[model samples]
Target: MNKSLITNLVAALLLVAGVLLNNTLLSLVGLFALSGGLTNWLAIHMLFEKVPGLVGSGVIPAQFEAFKNAIKTLMMEQFFTQANIDRFVSGQDSQVHLHLQPVIEKVDLSPSFDKLVDVIMNSSFGSMLSMFGGASALTPLKEPFVLNMKQSLIELTQQESFIELLKNQIDQPNVMAEIRAKSKKLLMPG
Candidate 1:
């Protein structure tokens, strides 16, 4: 269940029980509990945004409802700002290549040659003739194969889907709620 929905459900049950008991003290306690849940609900709202002109001044109604806006701005400044991006771009990170190299440092083609030969033999006769032929076949094809492999690698490296995947993950609501719940638990009593 969503945190807000869980809180609302609990608050409603507490309020109903307090009313049924017909006791003033229990009703007062229920009101406090309801307020606590309402605070959590409101807090979740203000986390991503802020209420306008909610000041941090002396004798003000809510001296720090603006805390949420300040926190949001600080978060953006630290992690989502252009300056941070520029800092990353200017830092030593450009040299930090994290892509994994192929497990086999060199693919030894010698072991696979028999399969290639068999495949060639199974194909048309002209291809088989070309496969068993002299240096003429090997010499011309080697450079093209190397160039094609390098081009394929370069294209793969330039793809941006990995970055997009991380971007999407960071914005998922369930992910955010789990993080929020865990972080809240660290400081709050049950």
Candidate 2:
């Protein structure tokens, strides 16, 4: 059985045996044990269960909502503060870099190549190009041009200089503050 039940049973038995044998010391000890056990049991019970005549029983259930709100407030104010978030982000190593090669590969540079062709056709070289196949002559260059452009962009972005520049931009006070604020808004929305 549970400790509370065992304690109460033992104490009650002690009290009955002591009284039947006319032993004052045993009786006193039994009375104290029984009173203490019952008192502790009642206290523990009162915390979780309401008693009709008790003023402040079942306090945990009664203030459950308040307790939840208090815990949320504590988490927000202490652990999820703006400074804490900023510190967490800032503490990361400078070597942390964003991998953009996959994104660059997915980019459609066809529009860019078309724009270039339009520029070339409208330029002073337009009349000379009309003598040949005109823009269609450049049409064959589209695939190669897009491929080369994407490769160049991927290389440029992967360069240490570009990574450093990007890191510096992100490390700017205004940028970091804005990032922290946005993260906070996302994490602790109303």
Best candidate, TM-score: 2
Compared with the true structure, the alpha-carbon lDDT of candidate 1 equals 0.56
On residues 1-190, what C-alpha lDDT tens digit does candidate 2 reach at each position? 7988898889988898899999988888889999999999999999999999999999989998887778767776897666765555554634455889999999999999999999999998977898898999899999999999999999999898987787677778788778766656665567
What stretches of model 2 exceed 4 Å from their correct place?
1-95
lDDT scores of the candidates, listed in order: 0.56, 0.84
Clashing pairs in 1: none
Best by lDDT: 2
lDDT of 1 by residue, 1-190 (tens): 7866787777777777888988667777768888888887666555545566643223223534466556655665566455444334333446533342352224444434445545555668646577667334454555555556555655564467644454456446565556555544443426
